[model samples]
Every structure is written in C-alpha cells, then in structure tokens.
Target: MPSISRSTPMRCAATSKRPGCRRSACRAPRRTGSITCGGRTSAANCPTTAARCSPGGAALGEAPDVVFVVADGLSAFAAAKQALPLLSAVRPKLEGWRIGPVVVARQARVALGDEIGELLGARLVAMLIGERPGLSSPDSLGVYLTYAPKVGCHDAQRNCVSNVRPEGLPYDAAAHKLHYLLTHARRLGLTGVGLKDDSDALLPAARTEAERLAAE
Candidate 1:
C-alpha cells in the first residue's frame, strides 16, 4: 500500500498581487508562469485527492475493464449502510456481463477508487460515495469515474455524477449517464472538460431527460 497525502503541490494561477500571498509554501515551478503550492495555489478552491494509498493488488485472471467501488466515509458504516439499498436495487440491472470487480471499500474516500482501480489494472474506475447530509436531501450520493487511474492523479481528471437520490438524480438515470461516460472515456482516453455530456443526445427523448436531470 502506498501512503496517500492531500498535500501535493499543484499549479497556481493566482497573480502575485493576490491578497495573503505566500510563496514559501509553494514547490518549484513545473511549467513557467504557473506557481506550485500546497495551499491556496491556482485552483486552490478545488478539493484534492490522495497521492497513492491503494491496497488491493493488481488484476487477477481477465481483469475488468472498469471497476465499480463503494467507499463509505469515516462514520459508522455510513457509506455502506447508505449505499447497500441502492446497490441492491442496481445489482440486478447490472447482472450477467463482464462488469469489473465490485469492491466494497468501507471507510474510504473518493481517491481510493483511483488507487484501487490502478492497483487492479482497470482502465476505468467508478466510485460511489455518500455525501454529507444537506438540508434538502439527507441521503445524497455521489459517483466519480476516472480513466487510467494511478498514483498522483488529480481530481480534475475524474468525472463526477452527483446528487443520486430519489428526489434528486434518480438511480436509473444516473446509471445511464455513468454507462455513457464510461464508454466514451475509454474511447477518448480522458474524462474532464474535453468530454462533453452528449450522452443526452444519444438517448431517446433527449430534451425531456436532459431537462429533468441535473448532471452538471
């Protein structure tokens, strides 16, 4: 298992004149004009993923092209407890077929999906996580998919499908969007901004479903 840290320095786009500017915390520049820093660098507002922290070993006997992971948070069975019902409902729909290993990562984070997928040698990884309870929807769930996951992979590289709940994004619709992105990500060899959500167009009655869901 590799030690994962959220402290990895990333490129900073902020100008030097920005308020509370500190240069000492930043690392050496990789690309000129972009500053590297551990805190408050360019895109500092974005969340960071762990560096490595993968435990499951490499893929065994016909590795799955895509791996689905369930990582609950620090709370007592919070992730699993919340995810089980959804999983149970979704499992039958996903039955029969070469769907990759479904790893139950209890007490884990979103980054763990990347690590495990990399370890398993999977081309793509989709991790379902429990979101913190908001006043609107207490049982919100989030899904994240990464292509070619490995150590040091950034959060930006992953595609996220969030607000998966009864009132929010429905389970069936979320599954469709995930399937659509997974296929396209493998084809394009990427996931973030470059890959647009044209999955709606691929589906019948595009505008109806598109208007109904909040994928963005």
Candidate 2:
C-alpha cells in the first residue's frame, strides 16, 4: 500500500528511556498541511494515518538511509486497518536522511523488503512484520534490516531483531539497537551473520565514570 510522504524528520520528544508503554493517541498536531493518499487526506489525526501510504502509489525522492515496509500476517483488509496504523505512528520518530512508506500483500515473505529497498535505491531497509500470536505474547513485532538490499539476497545477509513489544523488548531499546546496527552497518558496509550487536557493553568512559561514582 502506498502512503503519504513527509519532508519533516520523525522525532518524539516525550519518549523516555525507562521501560513503559509508549502507545498514545496521535496527539501531535500537524504544523504542515496533510499529504493526500488514495485521494483522501492522510489520517493526520491518527499517527499511522500520517504515514499511511497512498494506495495509488507515491514517488521516491533521494534515497533515504532506511525505508520501512510493513508485512503483516492478517488478511489484507484487516492488516490495512491495523498494522499500517501502528507502523505509521513511528514514522515521525524514525530519524534518517529520508524514509518512505511501503505496503506489502498478506502472507508476504522477507524477500519483499529487499526488492522494495533495491527499487527505492535505499542504503538499508528495515521491514516491520507482525508475528503469529502466541499464548504468552499475543502481539509482537519483528524487524529485519538488510544492507545493500537487492533481489536474490540470502536470509543470512540480513540481521533480525525480534520479540519487540510493550511487554517484550520495549520500543526504546529496540530503536537503540536498530540505530546501533544501522550505524555499524553503514560503516562496515555489511549486515547479517557476520555483524555483531555489542551495544549493551559499557563504553570505556562510562565504565570509568561508574567506578568514580561508586567510590564516592
């Protein structure tokens, strides 16, 4: 599904590092006019609506650092009603050189993100997918990041961050991990099994500060 486009960067001021639910009604009023999608006003009131893609298709400007595409397991109609909205809500906070919306069909596979990313000429691509509901975890989001995405890239060439939700990985932590991976991916010019996530390790300066503070 195509969605509206925005020139403004995505930033959430109220977001905090503590683990807490981040779900809030689309509260930020639009400073700029709405971008239409499918001949209708982008759901500006609903955060997701702001990122809701135009069903008719939208053009890509300069390739963004990352492009987020949604692939949900729900029926097309139902996914459009639910998944798209949720992903759209995060569009504003997704800081990058540029980003755009992409909607995939129901039951789509991970390869779709690669194809879309290659087509859009993005340096990297992140796919937000809905995982099957489980007894303990009913709603979970899975993220896959592919560097230099193109058709025929193997799954081993991508990096995955899974079990993301309010009760699980927490949005802030997930974003931090994603940012870490993206930064390293661009510098190393690669992603997948070879790349490692060491973001949890304390920095040298932080470790020194911790020891000094402890001594006091």
Candidate 3:
C-alpha cells in the first residue's frame, strides 16, 4: 500500500508509526478563520486546516469535486491507523474526480466536515471519523458523505459507511462502497435518503449467489 504523507501541521493524537500514516516533516500552512462547533465559534481555525492537490494535479484555487476530512473522534487511534490506508485504497477508484487536500480536524464532529467543505468549496465532503469505542471494537472508523456540504446540513442529508477496520468492514470493501456512493451521488445530484446502497447488486459474487438461488 502507498504511504499517505501528512500535509498538515496537526499532529496525530495517537502514535504515528503506523504503516500508511507516516508523518511528513513539511512546513505548516498559514492559518486563518475559525470553525464553528455546535453553535459556538472557536479560534482554533479548523476549517482551513490543511489542503493539498490530488494526484490528478488539481489547482488549489479551484473548487474540488470532493473533500476528505479525517477527525479523531472518540478514538484517535482509529483515525491514525485507518484513515490513510482507506484513502490510498479509494483514491485510485476516483481517478477523474478533483480531490482536495486531506483535512485533519481536532475536537471534530461529523458535522464539522460541512463547514470545512463549505470553506473549500467542495461539491461533496467525506468525513472519516473515529466511531465511539465499543468493548470489542474500540478502533472502528466511520465515514459520512454529504452532497453540497454547508454549515446547516443535517444527518438526514448524509450517507454513512461505518465499522471501517480490519476486524470490521475492512478497507477494500469500505472503499468500494464509498466509491459507489460518490459516483451515484454526483450522477444523481443527491445523497442520504433519496440514494439507496444497491452496490451489492453490482458485485460479481452477489450476482452469482442470486443466480444460483434462482436456479435452485
């Protein structure tokens, strides 16, 4: 798997020695503006956090097709370990899309991606956050994709892909599902409730199983 270099100055809360999550000793970008959490504004300037062009060489000034936000929610370890690998896995699938820099947010909520995406002028935002720790799955990661991300967007306007970890949904499957959602969201011009996850029907294995059941 390809290593994801850290473009932002923000340090990973957890140990950064993971395979794909290597830290890049690059200079920090100039910070400006604050991010709103819940109702109150913070001086931390979370929205303009970090941005880099995709492998496709999109210009920084242009609004990207998709913006990815990685937040260390309940378990920073989950974000530290899983975020980059998942990004690496999914990036090739999004060859033609304009991808914005990976934004790493501290003290972030899933809704925080809206503000970040709005600031970046992204058509879609994908928030990959650490899920609440469970006894058996403390490092589970969850992804939320929203179309036309803005400050006031609600949960009903986003589509979720959860339990993204080796022990759970796994990277490849999660990437496949996310790619499917993104492709359909852009084509259909919407996400959340109106969009359905019928990706399983497109899977070769699923089709084979269905055909066998029908023959039986």
Each prediction's number of clashing residue pairs: 2, 7, 1
Ranking by lDDT: 3, 1, 2
Q: Write model 3 residue lDDT over 148-214, tens digit each, in one string.
A: 9887788899999988887777677788889999999999999899999987666766345444543
Best by TM-score: 3
Looking at candidate 1, the ten consecutive residues that score lowest on lDDT are 6-15
Query: Candidate 2's residue-wise lDDT over 37-136, tens digit each?
Result: 3211333344333322322333466777776665553223323333334344445455544654343433445666676677667899887676667767
Lowest-lDDT window of 10 residues in candidate 3?
Answer: 1-10
- The CA lDDT at 171 in model 2 is 54
Compared with the true structure, the alpha-carbon lDDT of candidate 2 equals 0.56
Q: TM-score of each candidate? A: 0.63, 0.60, 0.72
Question: Which 10 consecutive positions of candidate 2 have the poorest summed lDDT?
Answer: 7-16
Tens-place lDDT per residue, model 1, 109-206, is 67767777777678887777878777665677788889888766677898888767656666566666777787789789998777777765665553
Supply the TM-score for candidate 1: 0.63
Instruction: Report, for every candidate in turn, its global Cα lDDT versus the true structure.
Output: 0.57, 0.56, 0.70
Task: Candidate 3: list runs displaced more than 4 Å.
Answer: 1-21, 24-60, 204-216
Candidate 2, position 92, lDDT: 42
